[model samples]
Target: MKKGCLIGGIVLLAILSIALGYYFYQQSKTDPVVYEFESPVYQEIIKKTVATGSIKPRKEVQIKP
Candidate 1:
């Protein structure tokens, strides 16, 4: 049936996507890009991706009295 085939195709694509994502994630874990910097020249890092305007999180410290 056409409906059965359509559902099967969607399921197949979903499984393929998950498998590909897992493979790429595993590869990145082992072979990630690393950037080392001298203490002074580190300000040039791109704070966020160009399209999205998100900023990095700041550390927080709490004082207990």
Candidate 2:
């Protein structure tokens, strides 16, 4: 029984190692990213914003004579 259990553990570990190795191998086979850059073009960008609101003070001050 002990020998059987030891063999089973080793088999499980081997399967896990093989699966991880295959996964990493597949990952490494992926194509590298190739970027295409274009020359800079001059263009006008205009942004206009209008806000309508009244601003008020949070606290009021009192004057004593």
What ranges in model 2 sit over 4 Å off?
A: 32-65
Clashing pairs in 1: none
**Tens-digit lDDT string for candidate 2 (1-36):** 999999999999999999999999998896889999
Backbone atom clashes (below 3 Å) for every candidate: 0, 0
Predicted structure 2, TM vs. truth: 0.46
Query: 1-65 in candidate 1: lDDT tens per residue?
Result: 99999999999999999999999998878666799976755456556555757876698788899
Q: Each prediction's Cα RMSD?
A: 19.9, 5.7
lDDT value, residue 53 of candidate 1: 75
RMSD of 1: 19.9
CA shift of 55, model 2, Å:
49
Q: Give residue 17's error in model 1 in angstroms.
A: 0.2
